[model samples]
Target: MSQARPDHLTWRHRLVALAMGLSLLVLVVRMVELQVVNHERYIEQAADTRASGAATLTAPRGAILDATGYPLAISIDTWDIYIDRYVWAQDPDAASGAAIALAGMLGLDADQLMASGTSDDRGDILVQRRLPYERGAAIEEADLWGIRSLPSSIRSYPEGDLAGPLIGYVGLDNEGLWGVESDFDHLLRGQPGWVLHERDAVGRPIAFGQHAERAPEPGGEVQLTIDRFIQDIVERHLREALLEYQSSSGSILVMDPYTGAILAMASMPAVDLSAVGTDGAPEGEALAGSVRNRALTDLYEPGSVFKTITTAAALDLGLVNAESGYEDTGVAEVGGYAIRNWDFQAYGWVTVREYLQRSLNTGSVWLSQLIGAENFYDYVERFGFGEPTHIGLSGEAEGMIRTPEDQDWYPVDLATNSYGQGMAATPLQVLTAINSFANGGLLMRPYIVSRVVTNDEVRSYEPVEVRRVVSPATARTMANLMRDVVEGVEWHGARVDGYTVAGKTGTTIVSIPTGYDFDTTIASFAGFLPYERPAVSVLVKIDQPGGDVNLGGQVAAPVFAGVAADIMEYLDIPPSEQLVAGQ
Candidate 1:
């Protein structure tokens, strides 16, 4: 009986050993499958568990500088406060106290912050943006467990509302939104990088752990042709003129005729990019007119300012000379449409020079008849009309022009267009076309950005000629005629003391859903200083002025004189009295 019991115990021990061996074999197979067959999958899962990949490093945006290295739009270091709800949930009592303390410092409601800190559904929350460095440092020194502050920046316009439409603004993600900012966004916005950081159990960045980081590349700087002093002077006079004339809006542009560099582009009702409504939109009157770069974007009937095109065509086509004579009855009949002078009066038998001096519509139609429709359209196209200037600006509108080939063609269109009507043009387009005379009949491509400075190189923009619209002699003749107009008694208001300036004025009836509004007019004046040398060309426009002072000579001409005088003084341009007398 003792031998049988020993044998039974031995068999039971052997069965237990066999079962343990089978269990060990199964465990080894499962370990091999996980470690070798699906190694990459498990590795990625472990990495994801340690790091959420939620954080990103933002590169600094470039600075926008003025002609003399003055900062117009700049980026200043700022901080953003964020909250991690998981850490706060772990210590409700302590987090509540911290929330109250933080709320006091941040000027936030304590109860609301406390509730936000206690919530677990929200993983992370942005508490505040654009917090001052000093204030954020104070919060960090307090050693709040759940709160973290990240380095960021906000755009600052030091000049404050000056050249607002041109400098434009950026979004929260550091993306450019308008004007030059939008036009040159890719160059201004630098390349962003990434960092792979491990987190703790409570979703906090671990100081000592497996991590990787790639540094971001900073953006380059953009230097514009805009002169800060000139911009300020232009805006000051434009603001004063807007108030004095009680006009709804106004714009002024000062350009270098030789280099095609824009010295000053100012628009009234300017907005500060740093100032916005709570809903993240531009507020008030600035919202309506200031958001658009009016000099390039908005279009209107150019009125007499366009007569420069007609006069240039007439002179270039050899259809008339300054000594040519025409009989002006104050009215012109074309295709059953009667076009009359602005004053609705008669001035009979005026020379070609007197035709422009008196701004006779009948004389302009007569010149158009001599040039004919085909030749007229040819000259207009050659002058860069009815087309975009491609001036490296966003929201540029190519003003409308109806050719003889279009279905809307009529003979009266020629007469009206000849006298600067029946068509539309942007202020920049008008200025660009008229610039041909100032630039010796060479149409130069107007540019705002003068240069760009990067880490490696400095790039400069040179004068680009679109085409030669007329002969140099013709341009000189046209300029001489314009100089005669400025020196004449009719344009005496446009003259600056001690200097002879040449320009033209236009007061067009504002177009509406109907035919036109005679009550509202767009008064504009375009002129260049030191007529003989021709340095700067100034264009001024006042929209919908109040009272009886609605004429271009009455409203915009004086403003041009004021702006021209200031710019000439700033540029140290010597007056040319001898040159004026010679002309």
Candidate 2:
């Protein structure tokens, strides 16, 4: 005791003690501030450090199903991969290894993968993501120290190019950008859920502290009017027709005549939505190819397709009977707008059947004149032209009937419009008008969506008649005359043997800007099966079909015949063998 008291502490010892005391106190204060003052914040950070990971937990998007529940688009389980840049930096050469590993997992070029940008702050790199589980597991088993995989989802189209345009794709952030996906994004994209927990100094979850997770709820499924078999038929024939006609672009639409439910819709140059990000093409180019929905968004002067409406107008207004006659010196001048046949050769005299059979522009003009502009315009409006179909698709064109809206309706406008010129409409618009004729008299709004289904219940979209656009009597006579346009003697017989095919052919010259020497044409044909109680109405439009023989009767009508005949046979609807000999 005496020795200890006598040997007092040195100055250095006292100074060291004081420094230790201050450091301990400071740490205590900091701990209290972090653990109590901002308890939730620090706890969350602690959880993240120990067990949890900051990541985008992608919510599963809704499935797009055909009418019979065949999936057009579906989301499948995938792996979300992350990389610890700090760990990779440990071995400088490992960065290349990391890229090589990811590229192998993703079936991508190793060089391209190695060069992708990374977060400069050494944050966890969202490296390869949405990998199929097996591929991700393989990468993980390789013990790529810098890499980790978490659960995620990616949209997959199993049918490969089937209804690709209809069911659009989503991004990693689960954003809908086009087609039905974008149109019904809110309903399709479900709410994302999160996890709350504590972590250590390093960003790893605590593994047990207040571990809370709210699993994501899947979105409702949308059932479309598309029949997978029917869609396949439409696609095949459209491509075949495009090849046969050597056209720049083609559109084929098949819809239920009475209900307006679109059975099959196909457009050339359609994009596979799932291929947007997963393919070799640069991201920008892949996206550019799918910017527009050709069937609904694009509009063209519906050459002969417009004639169906004119034919309906003629019959409805009693301007011409089924056997009405006309004189076709191969040309007819009306209201100072000279209309001529594509051949520029006049038949001294022809019946209405021969006029339409040959797709004579003059004959259509004469019919419109006989019906009078007011009456003709009324029938056109009744056909649902010049207005949005409101089919729940994004970016629908209302189409154009310039003369109807203009008070100063020039004779040229009226005359050109009657024969499908001076008028612009989309393929969908043409389908709707023709469907009315196919349905006998009633006009129904064309719809692609057939049902909305959740896991527990299904909401079916029943067909509702929007309006009776024409009298049954008017519809019958129009169909009769249109029957002639298909089977009539004056033009190419665009009819399937054993089927009572009734259709109209149209050839519209694209409006050339002043001083342009070249002439461009849009040829179209619209028809229905059996002439009455039709199961489907098929409309085929070929744009810029430049050839020595470029009439709708030659180009588009034949396409209608091919598609409609196949569809009828598929449905087991026996051919009526109905004939129309001369337009």
Cα lDDT, all candidates: 0.84, 0.74
lDDT of 2 by residue, 1-583 (tens): 4554575789998999999999999999999998789875664554455543444356787888888888888888787777665556656577777778677767778676555423342447676668887887787788775676766788878788776667676766787877778787777777665455444455444567456555667877888888998889888888887777777677888888888899988877677654566647435654554556678888888876676678777877677766787777767777665677767888767666666666677778778778877887887888788898888888888887766558866877877788777778888988788877667788898898888876567878888787888888988877777776666654454687777778877777666666222466777778887774577888888877765767677788777777877787788875463333321
> How far off is model 2, as Cα RMSD?
11.4
- lDDT per residue for candidate 1 within 1-583, as digits (tens), equals 4554444557778899999999999999889988998865565566556555344556777899999998998877777787777778778887888898899889999899878777663357779997887898888888787787766677778888778889888878888777788788887877764455577665765678666555667677999999999999999999999999999788999999887789999876777665654566666654756678899988888988777789889888887898998878888888998888888888888888888887778878988999999999999899888899989998889989999999989999999999789898888988888888888999889999988877778999988998899999999988888888788755467899878888888899998987999789999999898987887999999999898799898999999999999988898877887665666
TM-score of 2: 0.79
Winner by lDDT: 1
The true-versus-predicted C-alpha distance at residue 536 of model 2, in Å, is: 1.4
TM per candidate comes to 0.86, 0.79
Error of 1 at 71 (Å): 0.4
- What candidate 2 gets wrong by more than 4 Å, as runs, is 1-53, 83-123, 135-148, 200-209, 272-275, 278-291, 326-330, 404-408, 455-457, 490-493, 515-518, 577-583
